[model samples]
Target: MNDGGFSALVVLDDLAAPRFSPGAAELLALMDSVADACPLDSAALHAQASAELGLGDFGPRDYEERLEVLLAAYRDAPRLSRAGRVNLHAQFLQLLKNRLLFTDLLRREPGIAGIELAPPVVIAGLPRTGTTHLLQLLAATGRFRTLPYWEGLEPFPLPGEAGVVPEPRRERTQAAVALMNDAMPHFARMHEMADADHVHEEIALLASDFSTMYFETLTEVPAWQEYYAGHDQAPHYRYLRLHLQALQHLRPGPAGAGRWLLKSPQHLEQLPVLAETFPGATVVITHRDPVHVVTSMATMVAYTDRMFSDPTDPAGTGRRWAARIERMLDALQRDRSALPPDRAVDLPFADLMADQLGAVERILAMAGERFDAAARSGAEAYLAGHAAGHLGRVDYRPELVGLDPDDLRRRFASYERRFLPSEEPLPVDN
Candidate 1:
């Protein structure tokens, strides 16, 4: 059941003013010296990944320019702590390594390219719009291939790990999750991260192509953001599809299984590319009040920013995401018609909260999937085990995040009127 703001569970630490543990702070400070020694150089990182993986090819060279642009943006990122720089370097290097592994797999098994993919059920929506819950419920139905968090971290296994029991990828991901929980203790309240087996978006696949909004979560990089905005993402979307094909080829499930179930807030602005990439896909666009979305998003981003930077600015986060979301909405308003009406479903957040199972039924129906007894039972079990707000709560202060409720409502009035009319009272997360 949904916890609509009134929960006896512990309220999480304040995001407006994050308090780091003395031990954690000392560890971070110690890591800074080691991190400062590693610079964010694209060429060096590429060469390192090549040397480590014993692979010379990284698929296509088209992504090199974008990687270069992102590195330069990281160089210009403001107030980026040494630890943050270290994190960025590690992340980029891992992405490069993943690319190498993927390209190598494609090279070894040329037949992988011939593997056909079923039309996926894609969820496109902003953060805080119940997209994660919807994806989890659908995945529980055992009706689609979903990417687990561990797989998202490293899609391909290391050399000599094929056919190995108890994947090392999962164990490594579990360790990373523990470290992240210690660093950002309250993040689970805002976004679920308690388990490595949880469902994750395909944004990581997009990052392999060096074209995604995942970087912004670490810290603001307007230069990279601008570059990302100016590029055509269809090729990257194709790259994502190639990886999906590879994953399916690497691990072929029982014959005649369901389609892939995927979700990403990034797709809210890339509906056209999504449609073009996955023809005949079931596109579900979840809707919520923009004011509430912005406030919640701002708080979460600001909270996560503390891990990478000291003294995060909540107001700046609020303002930046507010504008960023507005641009997404504008793009949605412009490109929504790109999706065929029969294959698209509009899901309001209030309706999802009001009838979670019912929403699943509707979404499944839209995707031409049956809501069998097994599916319902699985979904019910998932809901029972994963109640909202069970991980505690966070006090969302819009004022502290430089958000005015009235002004926000007015700013998003057009979007509200278009998608969530006044008749449907929006549920408040509080």
Candidate 2:
């Protein structure tokens, strides 16, 4: 545990160390008890826990131990609060429901196969650099099969006739959508999220192991970020491939429809490993001014933290994001040579935003696929329906997000020269 580098801030009070609310503590205890009784393999347990926590494949290792400590502290603490208790109860209920659903699915379909995700055309980039909008645009082409939010949540039951009807699964997605609106009504404006037809990252499948970067943003815990950044995520993709096969097995695809279109910033760090695993895979890497990326991502992280935790600090969040991006970029620079030329393509954020249709054409062209007139029309329709101003509104200045603009420019000078020399430098307020 000492070597694990679980920061004192994660476990202490705001001024002292990281402090857990009583509800968070109680939820931890309930999970620990389940883990103790299940006696399952680590990966299986992780998968099960991920389903339960709504954490979406991002359950931490030593999850049991962490739970026990929180539970014990909650029980012993003299100042246990009502809000803490209520929060814990809600979390526990959700976890229980997830575990039951996951277990039942495994029992019903023994030896389930994973999705045969064809070589994906992945979009990787720094946050707030037009990656999301690009993915959504690409998904509209109909040539790519994106794992929609609904299917990702209910991967056990293949979406088919059931998908056509207003089923419980559909209801769940609607409920989630409603909750999102309640939590962050403004999010949809910055980046739209829907159940049925959007391209999403496969990171949640990796999150089952708590090794993904999703958790760091959800909770402003520096220790968690440090531990997550250094971990090898190559194995998670293997697991993801298996799950995809399993889900796809249930719903056979129309012939010639391309495999999943995945997107995630975390992929930058694991690019080499990803290439090795899926040699045939085509990758689309997005580039932006590192300073702009850092600042915008910090704003995103701060907003996300507010949804799940207390005492979100914009400065602290910015610092952690800067460090993580630096590491990811460094890894990308080191591993660039490992990727074959034809398999990789880099697109600048400014260029993509300026000419999204052209960008999509180039990306598909690189993959040796031509979008038919119908596909092109579909892409246009999607873009028209889900316009830029519809979701996930973000307006952030570098200074507001605690970044030193001049320093960032110098740090990412080489990257700018190589990938974005022609684009205007992101506006920075002194």
The best candidate in terms of TM-score: 1
Per-candidate clash tally: 0, 31
TM-scores of all candidate predictions against the true structure: 0.95, 0.74
Q: What would the per-residue lDDT of candidate 1 be over residues 277-354, giving only the tens digit for each residue?
A: 999999999999888889889988888887666666778888999999999999999999999999998888888878
Clashing pairs in 1: none
Model 1 RMSD, rounded to 1 decimal: 2.8
**Model 1 C-alpha lDDT versus the unseen true structure:** 0.84
Query: Model 2, 1-430: lDDT tens per residue?
Result: 0111211111111211233445545544554455334432334444555655444423223444433333343333333333333334343333333434444455556676443457878887777677787777888887776777666555543223345566565567678676555554444544567554455677655543335666455544455454555556676666566666655666655556657678888888888878876767888888887877887677666544444343456667777788878888888888877767988888877776667788888888877778789778978997787655443234565665567888888888887787787865453211
TM-score quality measure for candidate 2: 0.74
Q: What is the lDDT of residue 21 in candidate 1?
A: 71
CA deviation > 4 Å runs, candidate 1 = 1-17, 253-256, 423-430
